[model samples]
Target: MRIIGIDPGTGILGFGVIDAKQGGYRLVTAGVIKTPAHTPLDERLAEIFDGLTEIIAETKPEVMSIEKLFFARNVTTAISVAHARGVAMLTGHKAGLVISEYTPLQIKQTLTGYGKADKKQIQEMVRLNLGLSQVPKPDDCADALAAAITHAATTRLGVV
Candidate 1:
């Protein structure tokens, strides 16, 4: 199956596409959709919706593995990210993709066998899981791939 994983954010939403099978996986593409820092929230959301729509149409993913929002201390930031996440989910739904969400802890534990694994450790596991020569550039990009890998592992285990 082709899975597209999302790490949603208003300023920079990361996405990774992978072809997953029972035996192995391969990276199809991985990148970030970055909006200008000072842009209006409405505009940023429109950009995110459009960007993810285009990506879904191009990648033809059957499933989307997106990060579930974790409550943060910054209420302003959290609300904006929640909007972005809604846009991302809407885009996936409109494209007829199955949406699956994983909490950050779930993703971390699935990839690294630890709920509180550091970013570096998670990145290393992502690199090794995909047999990449080096870690995927930018933390957000690797994180998106980690979401994808988490889905693959979860499905491999016969879970949702």
Candidate 2:
């Protein structure tokens, strides 16, 4: 199965694609969609939507695993991220892909066997899980890969 993971953000949206099979998972691609900070909000959202739509078309993923919104502070930032997340979800839905959402805690727990694992730990786990030589660059990209890994693990265990 091919899965696309997304870490949605207004300024920088991260995405990773992985191919999972009976034996293991392989990285297909990983990258980010960045929008200029000075751009208008609507334009940024349009860019996100278009970028994600193009990604879904190219990857042809069977499913999408996206991070759920979890903001404890900064409502202004949270609202913008939520809008980006909505666009990402809409793109996936329009592409006829099954979409799953996981919280940061859930992703960390699944990848590192600890719900409160640090960023380094999650990045390390993702690297090892995918047999990558080094941790994926940029925090957002790694986080996106973690989301995909979380879904693959949970699906295998019949928990998702």
Worst 10 residues of 2 by lDDT: 107-116
TM-score of each: 0.97, 0.98
Residues 32-106 of candidate 2: C-alpha lDDT, one tens digit per residue: 999999999999999999998888888899999999999998999999999999999999999999999999999
Worst ten in a row by lDDT for model 1? 71-80
lDDT of each: 0.93, 0.94
In lDDT terms, how accurate is model 1?
0.93
Cα deviation at 103, candidate 2, in Å, is 0.8
* Candidate 1 RMSD to the real structure: 0.8
- Once fitted onto the true fold, the runs of candidate 2 whose alpha carbons sit more than 4 angstroms away are none
